[model samples]
Target: MSRAGSRDPALPARPRRTELALLLAALVLLALGFASAEGDIRGQLSGTVALYAGALAGAALALHTALRFLAPWADPLILPLATVLNGVGLCTIWGLHRVSDPRASEAADQLTWTLCGIALCGAALAVVPRPRMMQRYPYLTAAAGLVLLTLPMLPFVGIDAFGAQRWIGVAGFTVQPSEFAKILLVVFLAAYLSIKRDVLSLAARQLTIGSVKVFSQPRMRDLGPMTVAWGVAILLLVGTKDLGTSLLLFGVYLAMLYTATQRKSWVGIGVAMFAAGACVAWALFGHVQRRVTAWLTPFAPDTYEAEGGSFQLVQGLFALAEGGLTGTGFGQGRAADIFASDSDLILVSIGEKLGFTGLAAVVVLLFLLTERGFRAALESREIFVKLATSGFAFLLAFQVFVVLGGVTRLIPLTGMTTPFLAAGGSSLVSSWIIVGLWLRISDAARRPEPAAEHGADAATEVLRLRSG
Candidate 1:
């Protein structure tokens, strides 16, 4: 008999069928959304709608099929959730393109990138069947991450756009290396911390005031990792002027550190260090000062009218206000009038067209996606898988917070793209790769234990011996 047939009847069945059902439902919804967007943009549905919908469905189904064979026990919700978000992005971008100049239309490009991303995601699953294999090359990944992080700073390659030096133009293509770098660094951190969690978790010194325990500190030697992370964050902030990435890199580091060590003091010290660095940057950098000024008084005529000031911020706020509770309905809104309506300020565009209710629904989906990552982390058996999965989850959560917080003025506007929803090939590709990693880790976590299978075989053999 097959091992699966001989196994205990009570063992949980794989949910691959459920995954297929959800994937189909998500694709159906996306098709409807694409049709609706096309109708609204052109005043009638075009045949191209069918073409786009078919392509999207085909890509999604391909990924679903890969998971069925490669990762049958993986979480079912992740692929569907990602599909919904990515489809929403495509529809939104298409709508914006129709209303804007035809010469600048990016809908085709976005679709192509989406397909490439999904293909890469499937390829990731095929290549890395085991997540633990990555743990062996922590230092190598770290070195590669540092190189990518600094690649955009090299002369003759780095290109500055929108007041930030964060992209490199090579062979007629501009790429943001930091997007890929973040994942590599996360792997490095997870691997490093998993091996050192015991040392980092144990308190080396206890601070006391009048016999009252105040705080516990990690060993001075243990501070090397934090110091390196802090210094890298500062360098990113200063060198690239990319506030969003710098904050995200350091934030994920702290999150993974705490996840591995469970040390609140480490978090406290990291935050304090970052705060000090931010203050110094504010004092020393003109761009930092300008951003702070814009955040503080966005509506002031002087700030609003100045170059690199709060014009985009105020415009995004107006778009959100116009959207109000029910939104302006897809292509009807003027969000496309604002700069970067498809990229950095996408959340505002979504809020303007989809309204607060639609925005809330999107946020809920994002939360569920992040929750699934955390769930995988909890279910995982290996420390490395847990930390790596949780780190990726934290990266997604914090990136959303930074983007939404900026658009809403809860924090200074940081030019960060919304994952899966923004029109960036680099971001989309990296996101799908992260999804593949999540699937791999979750499969390993939820797969039936080999030990149990062996025990079942032994029990069956003993019964045969007695009968004989």
Candidate 2:
């Protein structure tokens, strides 16, 4: 018998058990976290803690069950990591509720959104059996993405909040279409790049300076896609007045483009274009100017005291400083003092309560999740899967960087939501959907090849044919 055919089938079953075990451990940790957070908030454990734990348990188990049935070979760590991050978000929201006005509590709403996001994630898994299937409709997905991205500009339907016009009022609910649009755009980019990668990778000419081989210039035709992408990104910036989404859209495209073509010039060109766009935006838009000013001198008295200024940024800095190494503990910090503390500044809220150690842990979890995604890309055979998975991974990582950098004064605040940690329905839903897609891709990547079974049969047939 061939060595490939001699492998044990039961080995594949072991990871499934490991997945369940890890999920159970995550559930226990979450339940304890809820109880601890509630005890700290109300000065005693309450029925609300049980309710929160039960809801989280239901959502986690539903996702696990769906994965077991739909993608038995999927990467196991993705679910547990996502669940822990989501649990942390829930705990943070619940903790913040103690300091927020009773009339405006977001804890219950966030829990409801979490459950809904999990349900939608499961639905996505059930419907999309193969990640490759999505590659069939690149233009269709692009159209949907463009529509969603532009929906916030329509009169009466569009709503401006926090000085950014990125939300649309849909049937009485405010939706951030940019969040979901990002994923669709990624799908479109992956499909399009997979088809065009060879041509895009080809160098039309070489530029040499004293035999140094300074540059390999691409064909003029290949530049069309990047131009279109850049134009779309700039339009998003102008139409939405959201630097975060604008940067995210263009950055993700550049990452995917580089992944497809393995060309560094594309990234250089994309960066230069985005830099020019940002300069023009800074010159023309007051909000962009304000963001830059705040980033540069957040502590300046005039800037801090101005309306829509750096007060929130300064407060977040104070909270982080107060948190020190071991934070003030759950429900003990003045996280509510910062505007958008639960969404755009959730990391600062977490840092204030959980301290630097806890914040680092959360960042580590995000890193691991992103690492698993990149691993999926490396393991996949299909070009489309590789590009799509890498794109999604980069998107998540970049969004986190933008959010964290903004809050920490590492970069200007772009009003981006931290995935799984921020309190926003659109972001939460989109994050879970990305997890679902990752699970699908990982399953396909890890599944045992059918050719292994036929190896011995083929060997015998070849021997018989030679003897005859």
Candidate 3:
């Protein structure tokens, strides 16, 4: 195999020295924060600010890795966008503690999680030298993803939060393995599609009817592997009572399949399959049924059973309306009025406090990051890189659409997050990892290749010498 990318030659003379300097500065501030005399929480633990500054320092290092390991590639816009979103998450997490019933030192815990998440992001960048290195463990990665999706089935491992069983409790800390699962899922899909793209695209039948040639509908034989994979994913989600995950995973498959084949027919088939599955799920699963029904008439009249389930959705709308055009302010949203305002309702928090400005800001940043990711995919020559980046970018965009769309009454509330801008360690870390992969693809797509003729003359001379 070819060697990994070389160090960035055009990087400034000082390069990561600046980032290191900031980290050291952050540590010093953190130390002083502990030592400073304090009568209030803010005065005592200026540690929160120091910790976030450290997070920024870590982000710079990851950006450097993008330049080296991914080669010559950079997302000039993505890192800064993530910085703002992560900063927003941290700030919102801190400020909202004014009301959390469990309090559990919300801001301090968030700072701790932010520190942990950043550490995890740095370690991933450190260990995964080349993104393809992850390809070696395709089965293992997919299996791990299955395990994460199945966590809620294991009794005590997963937690039930506002009707979604998405969190895993391990040791002393609770985490959402699904966050990490999403990254590994991308790796597995990229590798799988790389190997199967030709078969998937080529294994087909065609028929001419009346003058039009159309491909035959796929057979169970042709679709066995994909069907099995999709069935397993859906079963895992339904088993775990996580319809949100079910929807997300299905979208990933559809996006990957479409990219690998570039077929418009598959889109129609996919919509059909999705509609069929939804009908099946809604009929057999009461939880899924409840979610759909609640979404259908969150504020509509006369459904006697529509009473309890719409509570969350209505509150989400109320928060958004409260914020109006301009937000209440950075640190002052009345989010506690809604149950579970911290997670699923985080958009509500943004909408209420930042109003249209903050809400618009959140939407724009993710949109820019997603756009850059697709740009990287378009630039990539490697099939896996193209599919990987594009598929994952679609995943982020779709998740945002689902969650935000739901909470804002644009769609049903699927209980998903707003990516990095929401609280939760798994969400935070997975988001940066997504950013890392985007950086990798962007680097590969943009990495300046030495001119194809860089050694042509020397190669000819060497050949002449050898022949002589």
lDDT of each: 0.85, 0.85, 0.68
> Model 3 segments beyond 4 Å from truth?
1-8, 11-72, 99-103, 219-222, 300-308, 330-333, 450-468
Worst lDDT window (10 residues) for model 3?
32-41
State the lDDT of candidate 2 residue by residue for 150-263, as single tens digits.
888889998988788989897777889889988988988898888888888885477799979666677878767645754674596577887788888788888888888888
Clashing pairs in 2: none
TM-score computed on alpha carbons, candidate 3: 0.82
Q: What is the lDDT of candidate 3?
A: 0.68
Which wins on lDDT, candidate 1 or candidate 2? 1
Candidate 1 per-residue lDDT, tens place, 1-468, comes to 245536453333447778789889988988887777777677788777787788889999989888878988899899999989998888888778777864564888889889999999999899997888878888788878888888778899998887788899978778898899889988988888888889888855878999996778888787687457646744864688877898988899889888888778779988998899889889988988889999999999999999999999999999999998988876687798899899998888889888999889899999999999999999987888899999999999999999999999999988899999999888998999999999988887887554444678866764553232
Clashing pairs in 3: 73-443, 327-353, 327-355
Per residue, candidate 3 scores C-alpha lDDT tens digits across 37-150 of 121223334454566556555655555554444333455556556656666666665556643532457666666676666566556555765556666767787888877777
Index of the highest-lDDT prediction: 1
What is the full ranking by TM-score, best candidate first? 2, 1, 3
Q: How far in Å is the alpha carbon of 322 misplaced in model 1?
A: 1.0
